[model samples]
Target: MTEQEQQTEELRCIGCGSIIQTEDPNGLGYTPKSALEKGKETGELYCQRCFRLRHYNEIAPVSLTDDDFLRLLNQIRDANALIVYVVDVFDFNGSLIPGLHRFVGDNPVLLVGNKEDLLPRSLRRPKLTDWIRQQANIAGLRPIDTVLVSAKKNHQIDHLLDVIEKYRHNRDVYVVGVTNVGKSTLINQIIKQRTGVKELITTSRFPGTTLDKIEIPLDDGHVLVDTPGIIHQEQMAHVLSPKDLKIVAPQKEIKPKTYQLNDGQTLFLGGVARFDYLHGERAGMVAYFDNNLPIHRTKLNNADNFYAKHLGDLLTPPTSDEKNEFPPLERYEFHITEKSDIVFEGLGWITVPAKTTVAAWVPKGVGALVRRAMI
Candidate 1:
């Protein structure tokens, strides 16, 4: 580990395994090096891993107890702030923090979809935008605008900022998202792209940040607020060990695949996503997901045993919680008359290989359901 990890490891909670850094949400796990110089106490305060991911995204995932991460989201309810909520293009379902709009009542929320670089190159941008808007609607949000961007590629950053400036109208704007959705990265880019200024803000690994918020000042005397990202529900991070989180989370571009399937065949898209026969024959099925994840094909007859034998090792995120506690594999069968795109949640999407019927499966909570073709 590095010096920062070494310092953070010195801290551990007496009741839980999480670490405590700054109470600043943007600067969660932000302990000044000078603070440690004062002295070391032996009671065990917060966990060390929390410190690294918070400040560095270095992957120190701590096991948080219920109270450990159940932060005061209601605090924002009373603030008259413009909400800029970011969601990962991949893992959209897992990234959703429920009751967000209700908690921040009357706040105008702008849902920004980040990491568009992972999508298939053939995806039609406008159609995808509409799909995202529909998802936001289902999430109980009437966003002032829904913008798609890739912080890594700097795609659509200018347009996003321009729109935000127009809507912001001299109001305090807060950026929030569930953990691992690239919220900090987006904010970092926004600072550099919009202002050409570099300012240090808070970030951390475990959710329910120790720090409450970070403020980025604008020229109009308005402040752009960066809030702590909440831990997502049913995410692989929550299900897997720290080692697994690194292995599963994509750090690069994704690759899409096309497979022709019959009635009795199964295609396993990595350990996190699966497809089983629900009775479609001669169906053209394509899948889009992260390239890092492996895709294994097998006969549907052996699908169950294959999953049982290779889960985590193969069909991963394999129940860090417990075997039965994990979502059972779910199967969905669909018929397509035309060429279309089939998305596999955090995984990339597969283009239909033309005029074939197919079935797909995924863990119930990992979000492998099919949406309208975004072609």
Candidate 2:
């Protein structure tokens, strides 16, 4: 093969920057032979998987194996780089990378909470930042600074860039987060603001769009690196179909729904979750979740039978194809001594008043958390 011909064969995907290949349908960067031929002529192309995800909202599972992700994380251990940890404000707990402390390796991290526009405007910024810091501290992450922004809406992007520049010390900045947390979207905005290039990296509502690291050069000789998102087993994005994800993932600012309930009443967040008011007076239990997601009410005593009979039908969001994949729900009972939120991880939370008793249930692997209310 001639040298020029060999170089042409090594072109990368314009979408996610993975080395373009025609082999292994389930592997990263798999484009079809016909697509590659067409790309060669046009000089612009996306892998088949990315094309489907972007256009059709159809996800083709590609393994970002734990070992491979850990190896990529190891690259930052000794490097003089600043870590830009992005997270979805809506799914803050699920977006957290488990064992992040082991990977950060003494480097200062700037925690940038993305999707701030999805939050209610009445929710104070200082309160949210404080809650984030407390949660990070509990998780053993000591971030030097925290900034909130909505990448899609470009809210606070300038302030975020300024914060990044202040902390980076002219070193390479590594942008990292769990899959579906809007990491790619945030990086794309930064690129556009810095270089006026829209979507320098491929992004979509689906997880795992980026398969490898993509570097963006800065005018000051430093670079910003976009790392592939790590998949957390506990995230609901793993269990739901792409179509159903849109039903649960909040598209706009959340408006809390308050339900007046007495003891022995229950509320179901579709078929995916259940909340039982085990012991409480007739008081308001406010629920925060995607506005479009359906909520059903039933007697606590009949909740079990109700779920069993109507799981995929009336209580929906399993959407037929995803119903069979649903794992048995696990229950977590809590007695609220103070104003606390019963967090359903990838889903939203329920804010119960002090002195209320509630039991929350979610898919087995997707656990729930009880935290002091942020609002």
Winning model by lDDT: 2
Q: What's the count of clashing pairs in each model shown?
A: 41, 0
Summarize candidate 2's per-residue lDDT along 115-199 as a digit string, tens digits: 9888889999899988888888888888999999999999999999889889888799999998889999898888889888777
User: Which residues of candidate 2, in runs, are more than 4 Å off?
Assistant: 1-10, 37-43, 320-322
RMSD per prediction, one decimal? 7.3, 2.2
lDDT of 1 by residue, 1-375 (tens): 666666666463321223444333343344444443432453323334333444456653333443333454565688777788899876676677787766678888888998887766677777778888888788787888889999777788899899888788678887878777878777878888866754233343334442345567888788887665676655656544454456556666665566777778877766666666445447666665555567788898898899888775655555434555655666666665656555555444555544455565655765544455554
On a 0 to 1 TM-score scale, where does candidate 2 land against the true structure?
0.94
- The clash tally of candidate 1 reads 41
**Which ten residues in a row are the worst by lDDT in model 1?**
12-21
TM-scores of all models? 0.73, 0.94
Q: Largest TM-score belongs to which candidate?
A: 2
lDDT of 1 at 168: 80
